[model samples]
Target chain A: MKTFPIIRVVTKILIPYILLFGCYVQFHGDYGPGGGFQAGVIFASGLILYGLVFGLDAVRTVAPPRVIEKLMSLGVLIFAGTGVLTMLLGGNFLDYDYLEHHVLPGILPTGQHLGLFLVELGVGVTVTAVMTMIFYAFAGRVQAKHVQAKQEPTP
Target chain B: MTAIDVAILLFLAITAVTIARIRDLWAAVMFTGIYSFLSASWMLLLDAPDVSFTEAAVGAGISTVLMLSTLALTGTTEKASGAKFRPIPFMVVVLTGCMLIYGTLDMPQIGDPSDPIHIHPSPSFVERTQGDMHGLPNVVTAVLGSYRGYDTLGETTVVFTAGIAVLLILRRGKEEDSKTGGRPGSAAASGDNA
Candidate 1:
């Protein structure tokens, strides 16, 4: 098989695992050398690498700039919202201990490990979108410059 | 000095020399990438995986590529600055290096658990990080996002600011029919039509 389809097939097979690994890193960060920041970058890098191999046009068709912008802003909000929720729940911002609470009367609850999970997910979204945005920005610049040069008459 | 230390020092020296001597801006950028790659390796050997990873992405990867593209948009030829090397500034830099080396002479041995960084507060930081924060075993996040979160916030802001600045410098210029590179007219702009 040609490399493009092979890569597509391989990445298709691997996307789920890549996502799972990202989750693992984000969740297991408290004990390891990785956490949201590293996991976010790695998650974003996978998509960026995909774009590099496949082409920018393919990625843009799948995730348009407008959608990406919305996701990017939404990601920031999601991250901030978690912190806001913790504050509303009478904890300091991002305080997991405060998040570990029984919402219903006398119900047992696990500590708010899920809070970090959500935060990491948000971070991953924002990071990937922003990195792609950066890539596109430069890509656009090169296009614009080339167009201008071509249109210009000889000196 | 240890072998790793010597290698780091050697690369660091080369980095400085390359920065000074490479007349072409593109080569300077590539050398800087090499410098960062070497530093990442050194940091890995020193058990600072997080720093190494960050350096790899931001320093060697993003920064190098960005600098090269910027050079492409601008010019690769280094403009001649017609100033002789100032002896005073040279002496000051030399003095600073000497002082830093002298300070390192009294540092704790590499990887000494009894060192202040290891003994005084780090253990407690480690111990506290485990029980506190979200359940992720990555204490770096615990420390970064929880314990000393302000610094991490600052770091994140730096990433955000850099992203914005890059976007701005690289904003699409006006394009005409003859120009092949402009965003909208080009085939690669949004990729949807493509």
Candidate 2:
């Protein structure tokens, strides 16, 4: 990977656009064919491509393992916590109608949209983190094995 | 079906057969990616854009890369030690295929309005989504995010749990290394030591 100048150049050019498209898919999912799951996977693929081209160290600089671990839990928390908030707001669990209640007048759909957006965000975050972590674990372990294999030939 | 759909299906069959025949793991992984793309196109041809999008992204893109990473951990050449064909396992596969085909014989034709799947519960979801679900035009999201919110929550928890489990199993820190006598390989190394 380090020796391939063409891959480095092309990946650098393509990655930003991929990330942007992932964000578009995440946000525009309500009106389109994509949502958090697809968007998260796409976003993670961009990072994974960067990792594949540039190496795991570059990916770590972008998103360290600790940050990824925290983000994974936080995403689930946001999702479940939305339901808890709805429960506390005197509505049935996950009832988005309660979200916009009394805060804004005359816009009945605001709550549903807001709640859906937040939930999707949570899902997107969690998925992105998990996919990246899985890649990291696999790639890191393989790299370690390669180093070991090089250092000590099997007797 | 259109000619294009038939052509794509033929391509999918070819790819599947090629994947099965290929002994090189890398080629097999590439063929799997091709299979995913072809299936995604088939989904689009069937007027299922959402399913196609997911299939293209996750199946073709992410899963292929993950398999490649797994190949890096293991070996690229698949072992041919078990190459001898056994008739019993082949019979089981044939039986399963026959059962699946027989089961599908009872299914209603595609898009039949009288189909039980299109009749019950789905109509209600469709009816209420636009009006009561605050005009979220995408009925799929309305159903997945709001109507079946509990199920989605459960799925999210499942994803989180899987991530946790994988990290716990594969992640090695300085602490783990100290306990394992500084060998960074998998349990194979530990087994050898014992």
The candidate scoring highest on DockQ is 2
Task: Please list the residue runs of candidate 1 whose C-alpha ends up more than 4 Å from where it truly belongs after superposition.
Answer: A1-28, A45-59, A101-112, A153-155, B82-85, B119-123, B133-136, B149-158, B165-170, B173-194
Regions of candidate 2 where Cα sits further than 4 Å from its true position: A101-109, A153-155, B81-92, B175-194
Candidate 2 clash total? 0
Please write out the lDDT profile of model 1 over residues A90-138, one tens digit for every residue.
9888765666755663343334555665665566667666776776676
Query: What range of 10 consecutive residues in model 1 chain B has the weakest lDDT sum?
Result: B175-184
> Where does model 1 sit among the CAPRI classes?
acceptable
First chain of candidate 2, TM-score: 0.91
lDDT for model 2, on a 0 to 1 scale?
0.84
Residue A139 of model 1 has an lDDT of 56
Residue A41 in model 1: lDDT = 62
Error of 1 at B58 (Å): 1.6
Expressed as tens digits, the lDDT of each residue in B27-60 for candidate 2 is 9999999999999999998778778877988789
Q: Across residues B93-156, which tens digit of lDDT does each residue of candidate 1 receive?
A: 9999999999999999888888988877656776675556533566666666666644654555
Candidate 2's DockQ is 0.48
